[model samples]
Target: MQWGCMDFRLLTFGDLRLVDGKGSIVPFPEKGLLSICFLLTSSSTQKARAELAEFLWGDIPLDKALANLRQTLSRVKNRQDELGIELLLIDQATVSVNVRAFTNDLALLTAVSQTNPHTALEELLQLGRWDFLARTEVIGGSGRMWLRTQRDRIKTQMLTTLRDAISAMSEGADATVIKEAALRLFEAHPEDETVYQILGETYAGEPQLESARHIFESRRKYRWGELPVDPDPQTLSVARRLFERQRSVAPQLREQATPQLEIVPPVPRGPPKLVLLPPVNLASSHQTAVFLSSALLEDITVGLCVLKTVTMVAHYTAEKIALHLDRDAMLERYAINYVLDTRLNFDGSIYWLFAQLIYAGNDEVIWAERFSMEAQNLPRQHREIAQRIVASVASYIERNEFSRDYFERNPEAYRQYLLGQRHLKRLDLPDIRRARKAFQTALKENPYFSPALSGVARTYHLEWLVTAQGDARLLKLAEEEAGKAIATGQDIVGGYHQFGVAKLYQGAFDESIEAFELAETISPHYADVIADYADTLMHASKPGEALEKVERAIKLNPLSPDLYFWTAASANYSLQRYEDASAYIERMADPSQAARLAAASAAMAGDTRKAKALVRKVKETYPDFKIDTWLSIVPLREQWQKDQYREGLRRAGFD
Candidate 1:
């Protein structure tokens, strides 16, 4: 190999792009480009002809594949001469790229290493425009496998580079770079708390305590509703102290400061702590009116607890201290960030209530409202008051934090949540077990955690469904977990949704619909709830309603899981729209799960050969999948609905 000055540059960060010295694109046929890119990115700059042939053309017969490889290689070689670049060093036994002949972006990035991380980071950021071969395609067999491997390798290297850069900053290199790196990590893993900790620590280390405190506070308020154990607790303490000192000093300087207000330090970490003070009875001392005030306070506390994004001091705790001290003293003693104070007045046949959400830190009114209701409507009035307060507090937190509910601050729980979701989404026996374990781990750390508990329940229900179990043990267990989730406030929407699934599978169609309605009321925009609700509707023989709900789910969650499409397909099949059902089934990511459904729909849609092929495929995986066994396990409530499905499968050759 002879070294020569060359103008061509191979950029392989996000995309497979080749730019000449003059920054002009050196276009090559897709085949030739793929061939050159493969060799350029491979180890030792070389690969055997046999290996190349197997990877690039393995889907075809050996002789034809080899001929195709030869043609591609010839085109690649011709491109070198055409562009006046020494792009390849070809031989009878193997082909290699002459690394010294051109400047490659990946090589330049790697050469600098991450020791000079700022430059390396800048390069990495620029290279992130595309994956290994963003717009390129590798059709079938070993070629697709090789492409995946290369893409994963490059992505791994980028992530490693980010970690290295953050490490360099932590070691006292460039503190400013920490923010940029942390934000980038946030972009990559928005739900991950570790990056926010890193960024927070970097700010704290600079004695920029306000920024550090803000990061953690905002993360808690807008993202996680709480953060993980602080990574640098000592540094975090120092930052909190500095913030507290500033708050203390600022209030002292206010000449007109209220003597009744006490300047209390904020909670060091976690979501805002709120306490609903016992309502003051303004009506004449009637036992019933006093009892109603206490009951109202309890009701409000329970409602706030359901919005687990905020911490609510228990009613017992509030009762013991709420009336004994001034609001500021209560804030200081209990470290309460907000106080919900209420006043109740009772006149004949009418109940009047005054309420306000106050910021304990400054005694500022965050929200205030008054309610009047007939004495008989006390229960409804209490619910309305609780809902209003919860919504107001949520909005207040969002306003202070300057973000939507995005990050999951509990790193450990969130990690487990992600792991469990991955396994649950796969919907297999072993994966369901893994998902259960992961969810269990999450609950172990935060026992009252709702999402993890919901996951555990979901996994149990999935296991029961997948195994086609006649025993209701798993279903019962799933129900228990869903109740625990709702009790713990995991996600009001998800908890009800899981509960609905348990009810649906148990053939309690009306109760299941009621649960689903509750979930929909809580989170109207939640796609998973909509999708699952659609599934329940389909089982209840309401195919039209099911179709509408499933379509709404897909619209809400444009990139929803394959199960959403499968539900849509099933709903369409139940509605006897075979052509539409076939179209939706084809869109499913894992069509094998719906193989029987697809085959039936195809047969009814007049695609006999495709239907026959799909039936054969289903038989290969499910040898014992008899129509009678399937019908027995399916949750369809109506005999007519079951018969409709039975006839379709019968048409597709399944007896």
Candidate 2:
């Protein structure tokens, strides 16, 4: 595994880098580095040159791709004499990595995973980041696909190692290691109640009674708060029992400390509960179709969770409840207000998914639709189908819920308000202007409509974001509109939410936080409100709590929008967790939306190459982006926070 007189190491864990004997980074062209990575990580040490060429440059002509591959291989060969190490072996038709001359972190991890998984887990944690080939950006679609596949493979490997280590805990593994592994796993898979159980047990076994109690109590609260309608009965039972045990043990340890654990069931009196049962597969033999149907239903559930007026039962619990033979009794037991029952059937060629909405109170079928799709297109068409279903359901619910206090008295005004909301969610300058027009029309119909007033306020706020201009006039107008909304409808969540956003942008941190808190009080499960509150908290220099709030928001709206990821990334950046910030940015549908933040994070993380590349991209996209101008408008509560961001940007070669 060693070269004659030099040690070469390829690091593929956090970021891809090549280190020489003296631990200095060895620079290579992008293609050369990628070629090396592809060969090193491939199933076989050797690959056809044509395969490597297609992988790296599949978008180009075959002749040009082969030529480019040859040039990249020649470049690598040219470095051998200067570096005194052979890194690749090339022939007329094949390329192979000199596996013995260099060692790679991935290979080392794989080896350790088979031998000592505890060590593998420790190494995975020590990497401080899980992004593989983080700095490498591939140009071709095929290359991007390969990159995604490799990242998933590495993540699965890490999780498997963590699970293996946890399984070995019964064989007298270190308790600390087990706790850390459990925590890491929990971070990656928060929805898995098994991880929570393991974490609570690990703490309890440590005899840290208070910590164990907190863990169990937190689990219980999460189940009640996030999955409010129907939490997994087994998870709730385990958490409650463990919490009581911890409370019982605490008094014995401290003599005078009498801890009390309370298990309060969630009262189903807030928003109406809407449940989407798992789709019933007519062709049970087609398990793949059944899984896709369930996935589509889950997607619809997540999309519906964003609606402020309806509470969605957790998908896991809905699946369990769907199995009950007596559907009416089950609905009554869960206090379900609406049910979306779906059935999947295949008629030889096309798959038909029939969905219906029923009022659980009277067993009335309110709406039904049958969607047809090809079997091959099921996976790719789920998002669109989910969106259609969610939109139809939301429209029906909105029409039926006119009795709520915030609904405009005039039907025309409510129609205009709905139009404004659709435009506002697009989050662009053109849409903002369009939204303003719709809101203005609504105001003409009913001047006292608070929802329309709030919509007007949001248009101004969104304009500010889209323009990236520090326009005090825009903030003033937005705040004024929000104030009117709040004065007209004190109980409505939209007014409070819009007011908080405007106040935050105006640097009124206390007022903004108070407004968002009130909004939460009004609509406790409003995912967008919680996300904006998290953003306010981050700017107010309370990133730890901000992260917690955003995580809670994500739980409420599992398939959240780009803003949630941006808020999470900002919080992580403020906390100096650069890798985590980058990871969150990558989760966004468009990472370029936060390119500046990504650049700063990479710079702070000591990846200057990546930082500079990102800076270049930012400049290409936004030519007028001056760091000082953006910072002035960012509304950071503390000067130190602004300075930290400025420093990172400057280090990343930004103007």
Candidate 3:
């Protein structure tokens, strides 16, 4: 064996480890290892000997701690002969790592994090496996503080690495990189409109137009109650051109391109991917059907965008390429696992739409439906169809992705949650009770499942609303369960939504709005949260703002649930627009709440006969609903709107 040979190495990625060139673990006592790691990771690569001794052995007597430090250094110094390298340099005043003797992982990471992010990608990905000194026993005080600072520094460097990587990819031909970069940047800076502009321009197409418009409109409405507007004139022009091109494209391209189709590629395993193919207009007589189809497709895309477990192609891209190529070839080219196909048939005034979800792997149809509606009711129909499609698709994809072991372990809980969702969709009193039972059953199986907890809370709130009479006990139960939901799922969108609704029913408007705002921030495109927030705003005496939010919700979810229409009616009524309020009230499928609003609107508009008839209809269902109880249940802050509501009800024969 050679004497005075030096071979020092270090590892700081997952854990702190040191070795000689012979690959033998360096002989270090606990204090010595901690001291080495601390000095090695510190930015200055040095620290005062006394300061380190005090930090590491603070609880011991000062002189004793100093003696221990000296003894530890003595042990480390003695090992230098065996290890063939000086790991540390010590003086009476201070100590530091021997930078000239050993190579360090920290140094490598720091240099790469700033200078070459593309090369650092693998290291950045590996950072999660081992936190900085995660296994080390860092108790309270300076040690913990130092560890915290180091962790933060590592995080900052990781983000820097990602940013630099994105910057390097900015000039590449890969749209996927640009899209991912824009998405990551937005995650870091959500309110940056410049990033929004970048994403909008990068994905410029008909689909982008609708999404950009919705984003701009939603932000303006939520902040200032402004009317909806297009994002920009330039984007608007490009979108229109794309839409026209799609409408004018010849239908024979599918056949023409079939002979020239390239070999299909295999889809990679990850999250489920879907492409929503453009709607095929079967009746050709209704040119306006093109706009309606585009609108529905975009609405469905927005609805589905909230799902974390699914990836989707841009609607305009899907619409453009899908029609020109063979379906199998198109799916393969995009690596899509499922395709949503919609066909529209318009004859004179009536429309029939068929939607099907097809599995790309086996060319099997998973779900299909046919919807028939008149031209006047197409908007409402669109919302209904989109909601159903999204629900079905989400359920299908999630169920299919579950592993055998997961299903075997949690089948009952999963089944109960699905049943609860189905019952909740019915939006009736008996169905609400059924949903509560299902959710409770799910909780019994897995008490910590946030979705089940949120479901149970929502069912109680729905019971209070659909029954048209407030039960304080039901509201209390709602609050308890919603609190549990928030506790279990602090960052989940559904928990915040349920919490907001629970607070709204309790007349805690400020708290309700705050919770809803958090949910909206988490899922900005979620129409139900937006609609619920609008209702809270109406009760909080901000009818103008409420109307704006309701309209924006409708824009996002054009075929929204019946509750949205009821909220819209109430908001319009608060604004004293009896005609608009009556129009919206008439759209509600639930007769109990519908009659209450319709009677009030008709009475206010000087239609006594119709108002009295509607009041009789409401009394038939809810004979004990006093104006005071109604007012209490749906509290309003504006004195004038309250007076108007009471007068309307009184004229319609309610006491």
Candidate 4:
């Protein structure tokens, strides 16, 4: 690192440098920079990495300290590069500027900014230039008191600068600087028309007089219009005198104020920010480990994402927070404007959920709700949970996203649908049968429950997967149930997703493709829909296109069901992207499923040992596994395709 001085002290990282008091460059890893900024503003010379990491990455494990450090260090470099400034390094452990090395404007100002008049006033006057980190004030770590304290100091100095500029003008010191300072003062005291009147009076003999009068009159009018009253008599008389002289500057001033006023219009507050915190796996059922987490987040985020003005933080960010940490600090750290956090409890017969949304600024509990749902209605119950949260947030904010009647008039049908959903998740024959009965009951209650209809289709879809007592009968039942669901839910994306799965089950490639394509348009982030589309497209002889859709799906929902990844790997295999196929096949949930896909992908990618090991793993899961027999049981798009894939595995030593 090198430090150079001309107008600023500069430190360079690589080719990049952060100049203290001059230049425009900054490093990447914004959060790291923010962390450093927090440290620098503190009174302590050093802060523990653990404390910093806990604050910044509250949800991340301790092992990620190095990764977080590297990220922050890179940002310091980027910031220096952006500003062409010298960077001061304290390394990663703690960030502080040496009192002897160089004086930082932020440091000097921070001293006086905290108290009435710091003894360093004379020194501060020299260093106080523009608003301290004016551009950066709008961004995050804005939640930190340090930035606010620093900005408060900067503005106070700005006021001092304005006074000095005005003083210099009166003493005939620097006419140009005085005018610039007068404008800045005008900005700071937006409600003060007196400054405008004084400025107009001072510039009366020059060409600037008209411009000054325009400023005076505009402020007077703004105060009057917003307040719906005339200015005070004393202020009005001064402004009236200025306005009379400033007639010529009216048009130019009007042009400037138009866009400025519009830019700051009040923001509409919509549904509260809802962050679905990690649901505890109380039963250790672990079967629903990924499913419960992914599905809950999916429903909540997707539901909240559609609303305008509701600031919902992404699911990944929230779950990253440790459960034991304070919610307020997390909200502040994440810059979350508002939060709707939830928790779940499951007993043998019933599931209960409790949720609340709160404002970060005041810790005000904005909205709260509790739900009790039976095991039989889990799917419908989850959907209701999503809808209730939305409805509650909507009522508080006084805005509507869904149709008002969507759930209000059909409570019974919604309940029955929830029962069906609860049953479908069971993934057993008895559960599927029970789910089918609940779905039928829900449809009987209200025929337009598209989500419940989808649930019924899903029940059939799972029954086929269980490969129960009668293959032909179960497959036919799934097709008919899916058809009934499609009849009701065709216009809804969930309808298409379920129906598409049904068609895929029956090997109806063309129909499945159409259903998934339509579903993808309604909600581009649905992993299941995109994966099914890839499958259908592969079957339709468009493997390349199929692979692209699945890749897009992967990007949209990174932690979707492993089954989705397996489907994508299969698509990649069809497209001869064997390495890419292997990359995705690695994420499969079920050991047996992982083995089959890994064996195929490993063979295609020429990993002989991996292929043999995967085949062995599959045999361990399914002892009756023979390459030919397993291929027959698993549904590949074509028999020849399956034979060719198995042959490649055999050649790679998957006996």
TM-scores of the candidates in the order shown: 0.39, 0.46, 0.45, 0.46
Q: Give one digit per residue, the lDDT tens place, for model 1 in 1-655.
A: 2224577677764456777777777686567556667776665568888767865775456678778878887887787777666677778878877777777766655665734766676756654452466667666344554565555455455556656665544333444544555555544443334444444433442323455466566655555354221223433454475466446645435354321211223336665677777665554555445545565565346435434246666565566555675657656766778888877766676666677888888889977877763344444555556655655564322121111121133445545655566566466899999989988987776776676788899998989988876669999788778767765552345667788899899887875786777666555545677789999999999999999998887654444567888999999998889999988978876788899999999988888899899999998988877999888878898999988888889888997
Cα displacement (Å) at residue 473, model 4:
4.1
Clashing pairs in 3: 383-559
RMSD of each: 21.6, 25.3, 20.0, 23.8
Q: Which stretches of candidate 3 lie over 4 Å from their true place?
A: 1-303, 307-409, 467-469, 590-592
Q: What is the Cα-based TM-score of model 4?
A: 0.46
- In candidate 1, list every pair of residues with a backbone clash: 14-130, 14-131, 224-409, 450-490
lDDT score at residue 107, model 4, on the 0-100 scale: 58
* Clash count, one per candidate: 4, 0, 1, 33
Question: lDDT values of the candidates?
Answer: 0.66, 0.71, 0.63, 0.55
Of 1 and 3, which scores higher on TM-score? 3
User: Could you tell me which 10 consecutive residues in candidate 2 have the lowest summed lDDT?
Assistant: 395-404
Full-model lDDT, candidate 4: 0.55
Put down candidate 3 lDDT per residue, 1-655, tens digits, no spaces: 3323346666654556676677676656566667877877655678898768865764345688789889988888777655556768878888887777776566667666455656575544433342566567753233544564566566556555555555565332344443444344433333334343444444433222344455544543442243122233333444344445435545565234221101112234455676677675554555445545554465456445554345555554566655664767666766777787888776666677778888889988988887664443444444555555445554321111111122223545655665676566467799999989988998898787666788898888888877655687887677667667655545456667787777777776766776776666555556677888998899888988889998878654544567788889988888889889999977765646678878988998988999999988888877887998777667676678788889888987788
**Residue 592 displacement in candidate 1 (angstroms):** 1.9
Q: What TM-score does structure 1 among the candidates reach?
A: 0.39
Off by over 4 Å in 2: 1-310, 313-355, 358-402, 405-408
Ranking of predictions according to TM-score: 4, 2, 3, 1
